[model samples]
Target: MISRRLRETAVAGPFLSVKGLVFGLFILVPFVYTFILTFQRGSLLTGMRWGGLSNYRTVVTDTLFRDALKNTLLFMLVCTPVTLVVSAAVGLLLSSSLRGMAVHRALIYLPSLLSVVATGLIWKVLLDPEQGPLHLLMLRGFGLDVPWLTNGTVAIVLLAFITAWSTCGFYGLVFMAAFNGIDTELLEAARIDGAGPWQVLVQIKLPLIQPVAQVVLALLTINCVQVFDLVFVLTNGAPGTATYTAMWYVYQNAFNGGSVAYAATMSVMLLILTALISALFLARRTGADADA
Candidate 1:
């Protein structure tokens, strides 16, 4: 027994060591360095000086940071619920036995396979007010010129819509898996109790899928809070900073504005927010499971 245990340990020890080393070098080291940098001020060209919490103070008081926070929160509030609902609907539809449903599911999921840069560029061209195909079609067909990128409110809405469009398919796939795992006996029991389709969906299906929904909500919340690539490629936070996100602000400060310390401070705040959201969702999930 001891000789066999020694052999098993020898086999597993090297792989575990490599995994720990890689994780430490990448995630743990960077996280610790960023946290340390939040207290220091300077760029590569300038010598660093300890600034205590001044970087955090500046980040909290900056108007641009506030705007970025507001936009990020707004995006989270609006997009997460909408994405959840749409994903659930799509998942239910795809899980049906209707003919050609597989093809429809594939088509819907195709957009998510595109790179974020490609997705943004494609939508940017399609939404051009003057010369794009969408605009031209609307102009000729309905005689209306829609200002998609030029208006602040409309631009934010478009960003949210595009984000949902690109991400819903992936979430739909997740939901479909959850839907598939549900017990068919429960659904049949609900149907036999004179429950209509809507009643079964609302009371039975949704309740059973709450755990998956919570996970999706937490993930979408983090994604929305950290949204940057689409905003960068699409609006560049234009229309007077209307669509600027927290991550975009972090990038601007760290790279363009030469405020790396402040950027690190903001990054910490975003991290805290994401952590809190995840914690809340997990707590709720745990409590619900215990009650059940």
Candidate 2:
């Protein structure tokens, strides 16, 4: 029996070791390399030299870094709330017994299925300043030539709008899934207690779905911080660094600007920001849980 058990254990050990090795090579090794490169001074090709706090200092003191951080934060602040609200609204609207709801939901969610590049291109054409359909319509109807992608503040707002519009339907589906899980009996009880639809949604239903909302907020925050493709395709961080996001800066430094070490450092700062946000969210949730 002991000999048989030893043979089985030996057979399993190799498989387990292989799995561990694969994970380490793919995940752990990359993470460690990034951390090391974050502190290196030389470019990607010239090889790394220990620069200690130099990279971090550059990231902290650079004016462009400040602008990128500010813009990124502002985008998050505006878009996160708008997406959550709009998605929740759509979810609530579709959760009813409306006719042809499936088709409507599909139409709304279809944009999210498209590639980011495709969405960006479509919007870029639609929002063209001079002759684009949207611009032409606005000019003809309202006599406003809104330079959606040319101006700094307006461009940032446009980015927020585009991001929210593209992704809200997907989030709506998320909220719908959570809404479906809710007990009908609770809603019925609320109605019996003279609670109207608005009251039920506000005072009862929304509270019940807090967990889903928390998850959505966390996910959106992370996505906002890592936003790159839309900024790249639409404005390319133009208008004097107005739409210059943290990730865009990282990308430029890493590839375009030949500042790999600085980019790595920026990436590390973004990672730290993400971790801090996650920590704050966890702490808030813990406090709420304790109160309950």
Candidate 3:
């Protein structure tokens, strides 16, 4: 069958030729170019030189790179779990046949529909120190105006919160779908065994949905690590590089600051980190499946 297909492909030469051309131009060429440019030295504007491992060493040893790595990891640590928790809770609530559930779901999911730039701008205004609604409320309540985006620690936390609120709807939908896929009989069996709602959820539902949760976590980790748009629009890696994520730094070097080779190196590093995290999660899943 494989030999017959190959013979047929060879006979249908034009279509196959076009496909080969498209694949080379779209995938192979760009990948080879980017890989080559990663090792290129000199300013993006002036010229290109072969720098060997210098770009990699410079990026690794730079203090800004270290800070970006720390900040990116911290953001993921805060955002991923918070998103999963809030999303799972919301999914559970949505699964229940509560009153006005449609309205509740719509309202909860609304933020995810907004563009990240729009959401960031809205939050920036809302978090303004002098005249924002949240600022006024906090000032009245606590007798102080906290700089939501000005302070290093506070900015990081606030960025996480914004990311969580924006992404919770999408993850909530995923969890809800997973929740709905469970066999209804399992819940009845648990109840028949004198299991309460909490027990049924914790023991039966959660364990059954563990795979989905793991997928969500992996995706959330990727998103958190690659985050840039909202951070750029809101803080621009302010407060002395406190919110500078790896992607943010990469963007600065590649486009904003004209360090194309360095940006390419950072891009490769991010790819490596993402691949490692994805592999770890996949391995755990495979191991669990094998045991099962």
Candidate 4:
């Protein structure tokens, strides 16, 4: 029985699907190409040449890249937690058995269905100081012309929360499913024993769902690190380069600046950071399971 179970868990034979192999091949090809390019220096006009680790050296000394990395890190730090908390709140709200919740949940989830471009444009219009509904409302109601996207700190925070609002619907649905999986009997017993909603949630439901929470956190971290499109549409790293995320920097260097190889080096570094964070989460999860 143990051997059969071990075989089931093994990485060879039945564990590798044909479609998965094809998908992995597609992923692997780009990874290899990126790493190979990282070692060479070239441009659309200059063509490719073997430049060795000069790009790596450039990455080490590039102040702009440093600022971009810092911004990306800050965005991830703010966005990931905000996403998780907002997702959890949405999940908890939707997991209830109350009537009309399907419609409400769908309404809440509608943002995730829209393309990033569409949502970003929607936000752009809404944030416009003169015409944006939100801005106009703030002005009319409070007599203040709120700098919706002009200020640096406000822009980053707004970008983070807006991204969170857009993406949380799907993760929120994940949490909803997690919540739905909790045994009602335990909840009833907890209530009978005088545990309040917050206490039961804190002591029982959350602990039971730690595995799901870890997965959500890891995925959110990875997504936050690669964020670019919304930044492109919204700020374009404007108002003094305040929102230049890692991937945005990579894009700017690759296409706009025509330093594909140098950009690939940064891309590789971003990939490493993602891998390390993912491994950390997996390792922590494994250790917790072992302690259990």
**Residue 108, model 4, lDDT:** 90
- What's model 2's lDDT at 63? 94
* Cα-based lDDT at residue 289, candidate 4: 93
Number of clashing residue pairs, candidate 3: 0
Clashing pairs for model 3 are: none
- Of candidate 3, the 10-residue stretch with the lowest lDDT total is 253-262
Model 2 Cα lDDT, one tens digit per residue, 130-163:
6689998999999988979889888888888889
Give me candidate 4's TM-score against the actual structure.
0.90
- Using lDDT as the measure, name the better of candidate 1 and candidate 4: 4
**Model 4 error, position 27 (Å):** 1.7
In model 1, the runs with Cα more than 4 Å from the true position are 1-3
lDDT of 2 at 17: 98
Q: Runs in model 3 with CA error above 4 Å?
A: 1-28
How far in Å is the alpha carbon of 156 misplaced in model 4?
1.1
Query: Model 3 scores what on Cα lDDT?
Result: 0.90
Clashing pairs in 4: none
Tens-digit lDDT string for candidate 4 (1-292): 9998887768565556776788778987888988999989878587899999999999999998999888877888899999999899889999998899999899999999999999999999998876889998889999988776788778888888988999999999999999999999999999999999999999999998888899999999999889998899999998888888889989988889659899899999989999999999999999889988
Cα lDDT, model 4, residue 90: 89
- Number of the candidate with higher TM-score, 1 or 2: 1
